[model samples]
Each structure stands twice: as C-alpha cells, then as structure tokens.
Target: MPAPPSAAASTTNSTATLDDDEDELNDLRVAIAQLISLPQAGSEVKEKGRAALHGTVEDMRAFLDTGYRLAQAQDDRVALAQLHSKPDTSPELKTAVRAILRTSDPEEMRWFLEVGQYEVDQ
Candidate 1:
C-alpha cells in the first residue's frame, strides 16, 4: 500500500482555518450582543435581527458541511467584489451589493439586500 501522508502535508491539507471559524463565531456573538445592548430596537427590528443571526449560524454550518474546501464558496466574496466593481452591472444589483458592503453588523440588512426583499433608499 502507498505510504500515508506526512504530518506536514496532512496539516497543510486542512480545509478550514481556525481563525476563519473564530471570526465567524465572533460575528455571531457580536450580533447577539447588539440585541441585548439595544433594548429599543423594536419588535420588527428584533425579528429581522434574529433571523439574520440564524442565517449566519446556518451559513457556518453549511460551509462546514461542504468539507470547507469547495472553491465556489471561497470564491463567492471575490465574485461579489468583481460584480460591484463593474459599472455595467444592473442598477438593482449594484444597489444590493452596496447595501451589503455598508456595514458588518445587522446581518439582516445584508440578507434583505441579497434577496431583493428591501430597497435601499438613496
């Protein structure tokens, strides 16, 4: 039988980095903290925020489920950047991406933008 991979090779082949998972986990924590900190966020905002937080958690699970090595998932952010840079893109798409890039908090805002469920006021 062929020899097993060397320790160095095996370590290098790990598809997910601890730093990445930690950062995503930290994001979830921050999102949760916001709800606690801002008691006046209102029922509608709270509902949206909770859903967004749930989505972020699910996204992490989905990423882990894919062996964390799928090129497409890794490439999505890059693609988003490329599309945002292209002036020829449709107005609606550009508006949506701009909304996503606006803030790292309130993940629901980004989801709404991505799904075209909410329009960003100029």
Candidate 2:
C-alpha cells in the first residue's frame, strides 16, 4: 500500500461530516422532546403507535384484562393496537386507558423513535 496518508489530507473532512450528523441528531432530539412535553401529544401518538402495534381492539382488552401492565415501549405499542380495535368500548374504559397512557406515551410525530415510555395525557 502507499505510504499512510497525512492526517490533514485524509481526516480533516471526516470531522465535518460527523459534526453534521451530530447536529441533525441533536435537532431531532430537541423536536422529539418538545412533542413529549405537550399534553395531547401522547394520545395523538398512541393512535399511530397503535397502528405500529398492528393488533385488534379486542386484543388490547385481553392484554389489559389481567390488570398487569406492559412496561416496555414495544409492549405498550402492541397494547395500543389491541385497544384501537375494541368494539364500542365505554367512556370509562377510555378514561382508564388514558390513565394507563403514562409511561407508554411516545413522543408524537416522530413515530416514537426513542422507543421508551413518556408522559401520559390526563
């Protein structure tokens, strides 16, 4: 192989690219944080996140039936799918669902990119 390239010639541009990527990532994080801070973002997110879950509403009722709750972001997404398909669920159940929304809540619009729990809408 040729002699090792000089640091200035080969590596000077690498840092600039890395910095661009870092800046983008940081901006995304800030936007996500803002959405999480909003009270309604959680419920709004639950809808799409529920779609990501890909389950019927009955499946949701069954999941929650045991009274045991899912603590992980993926589990909560699955739970939302099940709830979304439920037929004619009462308002009380809605209230209860909202209550449980805490921790399961994902930042809205970003499609829960963080993959963890968030604040619930009361």
Give the best candidate by lDDT.
Answer: 1
Model 1: how far is 25 from its true place, Å? 2.0
Clashes of each: 0, 4
Per-residue alpha-carbon lDDT of candidate 1 for residues 39-94, written as tens digits (9 for 90 to 100): 33444444454554566677544433442323222233444556678887677777
**What lDDT score is found at residue 76 in candidate 2?**
48
Error of 1 at 50 (Å): 1.3
Question: Would you estimate the TM-scores of all the predictions?
Answer: 0.32, 0.32
lDDT of 2 by residue, 4-65 (tens): 87899667679888888777555544444443344434443444334323544443333333
Candidate 2 local distance difference test against the native: 0.45
**For model 1, what is the alpha-carbon lDDT of residue 109?**
40
lDDT of 1 at 23: 84
